[model samples]
Target: MELRLTLSLTAALLLPGLAIAADAHADTAPAASRQAELPAWEQLSAEQRELLISPLRDRWNAQPQERARMLEHAKRWKALPPEARERARKGVHRFEQMDPEQRRIARAIFAATRDMSPEQREQFRKDWARMSPAQRQEWLRKHPAPEGGRGR
Candidate 1:
């Protein structure tokens, strides 16, 4: 009788742990299924293909380093959440719409602000918000594009 009671107690303790493990496993099932369903290269649409291989003809040979970098970027991009991916796509679209001069100015501003502390960045935002459009234009004029051009 004592042996049976001990066995019963052991079962009771293990049952909750088994249940918790099963719940954790169930939560990951959807992500596992998603990973399983990764599309083949041929299955991609033309637009998707263009996005994957834009501005690169003969990517296999002409720019091997760039192609490798792009491949790494693609892997990281695929790991992003849906909302983050959407926001990035929108940003790219907005950047594409800018003229060369505007692009240069925006890039310069972004580079200048990239490493700023949170407080410093907030102060900059406040100062920018206080600027008139003409003042903003003048600021861009003062900080012309870096010499020797920008790439990457």
Candidate 2:
């Protein structure tokens, strides 16, 4: 009976360790496969990849409702003329280049703009358009850039 109890206790301790080892191996195995499958972009360091793709990818992978909204917006974007797409891509590049604080303010502005009614959005656009370049620069000056570099 003592031998049996010792064996049982040993098995109990060893079994959990084995299971944990198996789980760790299993998890890493798939990640390795995924890394292999990833494109050149995925081969980049996480920071570089995030810098290049996070905004659109995050938008795409947001919660289901938000994802649907983003998809709808993308469909509309796709329908835009090539020149418009190029212009929009330039805008996105600018946004990506902004420091974190500026990006945060821009995100807030976008959220507020998106929440506005069509007429309100149009009014905001008109107001923004009326601002002088100096005024726009001053507005941006109020928001400080993030330290320690942009989100990698």
Candidate 3:
């Protein structure tokens, strides 16, 4: 998938986009700049600071290419229209609220559909709509998310 689409899906499916973007490039910043920025970070309430810090820490710990990609993705996210950003934010929030099984179902659907043609996606939706709750659960049990996927 294209990086932008992948980021959109991952952000919508996995984490909130705007918050993570802020932390993406922190490590590449010069030391003096970081030092100069410390007080601003300190001024934030612990909750506010954590909103930014955790993502930065994750970025810092990522493989070099992954870090660079995350930074790039963050930049792209920043450039999105406000409505688009809001939509993604809401999507992340909804995803965050799902029970693990629901999230697994979501991830399964996402993985199954991400690469589909329009017609194929339509057909899958039709098939999905035909399944009873138990059947849906059975389908999901047969096709669990890849190891450690979907917030596991």
Candidate 4:
């Protein structure tokens, strides 16, 4: 079943001309008639647009590589089971709730993790999984920010 879904997704991505044709027809309708189209993201309340679709829209409009990657991510998301999709949506919401400094720290951690070898990463993950709440707090306390401060 997974293989069949994977094949379907692969075919859809590889033959995007068909998708473009379908979207072209959809786009031909009068702009003012499109009720579902969102206004500028900044105009909406944060709760109303949790994930900030504006960044995705800007990337889609300006960067072909980023647009392609986003499309691929969307396809993969669509292929996920409903439960997995819900979990992913929750994760995205959590990410959106993070402050800019927290987000930057998370991104840096991710980049550092990505640079690690698979075996090292697995060991790190295992060690992290084993850490108790107290131990985690202690580790953070020991790793205090530099003289200026965390953001600095």
> TM-score of predicted model 2?
0.36
Find the candidate with the highest TM-score and give its number: 3
Report the Cα lDDT for residue 8, model 4: 22
Question: What does each candidate score in C-alpha RMSD?
Answer: 21.5, 23.0, 10.0, 14.0
lDDT of 2 by residue, 1-152 (tens): 21222122221221111112222324445657966755686466876555555556654566565566556555676687877655555555455456655554454345335446768866866666677878656754663333422211
Cα lDDT computed for each candidate against the true fold: 0.52, 0.47, 0.63, 0.47
Q: Ten-residue segment with the worst summed lDDT in candidate 2?
A: 11-20
Cα lDDT of model 4 by residue, 1-152, tens digit: 21222222222332222222223335555657653675666786774454444445655788785576668767876788887655544544444466755444334334334446768766755665587868745644564323422112
Give TM per candidate.
0.49, 0.36, 0.57, 0.40
Evaluate residue 23 in candidate 4 and report its C-alpha lDDT on the 0 to 100 scale.
32
List model 3 lDDT by residue over 1-152, tens digit each: 22223234544653333446445556787869977876765587887677676766776686565666667667878887888777777767666666776666677766767667868876877777788889877977886766656432
lDDT of 3 at 142: 84
Error of 3 at 98 (Å): 1.1
Pairing residues by index, what is the TM-score of model 3? 0.57
Which regions in candidate 3 have their CA more than 4 angstroms from the true location?
1-11, 14-54, 62-65, 150-152
Candidate 1 residue-wise lDDT, 1-152, digit = tens: 21222222221221111112223323345757855765788997886566555434445467676666656655766787887665555555455566776556655565455466767756766776788889878977886656643322
Number of the predicted model whose lDDT against the real structure is largest = 3
